[model samples]
Target: MKLLIGNRNYSSWSMRPWLVLAHFEIPFEDEVLLLSGDGWRETLAARSPTGKVPVLIDGALVVPETIAIIEYLADLYPDKPIWPADLQQRALARAASAEMHSAFLGLRGHAPMNLRANHAGKVSADAVGQDLHRVETLWGQLLARSGGPFLFGAFTAADAMFAPLATRIRTYGLPVSDTSTAYVEAIYGLPAFQEWLALALKEPWIVDDDEIDVIQGRVARGTLA
Candidate 1:
């Protein structure tokens, strides 16, 4: 299998399946496209049907979209315990994952993921602020259900789905409860996630659009630590 991803620094969608693959130790070739520079759409369109990163190419199969890739992985590796063992838990996890995949536009817009830097500040927009609060509520509920370290016990696709949001919350220093803060820290400390973050810090390319606070004259954090 060959996994196509965008630059590690800015591609939140790419990080989802990438995290799943890495966390589960699934073997696949990694392909990266620099999201910056000329004709990025043309470049992506040539490879992926959706023209998006995090697409998985498995011999005859060509899969696009983050959730699709994750589901494909789960199907392909049925014994990996990619979802919860309990039927109800798995259903709830899927619901949470789907909610993350489609909803939370405000949080996503205002808090673009940048693993390299931390820009601590309040999100001024009413919608974005509400989104932040909603996330806190959601995290608290999920963490309570799972009882720590990950959204679900023993990391699953659900955690992978929300991984980038953890980075976003920290990067923007968006307000989160201490429980949410602990969850964020636990994610950051994951070996696979830390590997992604380390790679992101070393990338030469940067997306001007994702550099939201820096462009607006806020002090940029020097490290992801």
Candidate 2:
């Protein structure tokens, strides 16, 4: 199996299934395409159906979209348990992951994912506040139900889905309660996340326009606190 990913420092979509694969200790070759280059476009167009990053290529199958890739991995490695075993828990996890894939436009647009950049305490707009509220509410509910650490008491696909959101929370210093803060801390402390950050730090590809705005002191040296 092979996974095609985008810039390690900026590609949130690439991070999702990559993290899932990492968590399961799946061994697969990776092809990293630096974004903003014609080479990236050509590579994606030649390989992926949607011309996007984070496409999974198996023996004779191609999986696009982060969730689909995750589900495919889960199916292939049921013993690895990409999702919770309980039917209800699994359903909730799927719902949460899907919600993340579709909703939170305000936060997504205002605070794009840049793992190497740090823009702590930078609130974008009024709508951002509402988005944060919704996220925190969901986080609080999940944590309350599962009781600690990860969203489902152990690392699962839902947590992987929201990992980028956790990055955004830390990057923008979004308003979050103590419980939500703990959840974010749990995510950042994961071994897979640590490895991802280490690789991102070493990456040389820098998209100048994607650099977090410094005029408002939102980003400091491309990393958040």
Candidate 3:
């Protein structure tokens, strides 16, 4: 399997499945496309129908969308516990993954992930607040039920799904409960996540569109403490 992704620093969509593959000890070669290039759109359109980052190419099959990639990889490696082993837990994990895939637009728009930049920021819009609250409740419930350092007690696909959001919370210093903070730290400490972060910090590429969101808020990213 060959995974095609965008920049390590700014591409959250690319980060999800990459982490999953890495954590599971999956043997796959990854190709990185520097985003925001002059021909970036053309590059994506040639491979992906949606013209997006993180396209998985397995043999002749092309898989777009992070959730789809996860599903494909999980099915291919049923021996591996991609999702939870338990039926009920697997269902909840899938639900959580789907929710993470579609929800949180406001948080995403206002708090773009930039591993290199450390700034405290806040979103003034009510929609962002609603998303934030949803995250707190959603995460709090999952953690309480699982009794976990991870959403499902172990690092499953559900953990991969929310990994970027964990980065976003830390990147923007978003207000989250102690439970959520602990969950973020658990993800941060994962060997795969640490590897990803180390690679992200070394990248010199910059996307102006992603970086410009930082100026929209005056809140300090990590200085509020």
Q: Which pairs clash in the backbone of model 1?
A: none
By TM-score, how accurate is candidate 1? 0.92
The list of candidate 1 runs beyond 4 A from truth reads: 125-127, 214-225
> What value of lDDT does candidate 3 attain over all alpha carbons?
0.86
Global fold similarity of model 2 (TM-score): 0.91
Q: After TM-score superposition, what is the CA distance of residue 29 in candidate 1 from its true location, in Å?
A: 1.5
Worst 10 contiguous positions by lDDT, candidate 3: 216-225
Instruction: Compose the digit string of candidate 3's lDDT tens values, residues 67-97.
Output: 9999999999999999999999899999999
Q: How does each model score on lDDT?
A: 0.85, 0.86, 0.86
lDDT per residue for candidate 2 within 91-139, as digits (tens), equals 9999999999999988777788878776775556474888889889998
Instruction: Point out where model 3 deviates above 4 Å.
Output: 122-127, 213-225
Question: What TM-score would every model get versus the actual structure?
Answer: 0.92, 0.91, 0.91
Output the lDDT of residue 111, model 1.
Answer: 73
- Best by the TM-score measure: 1
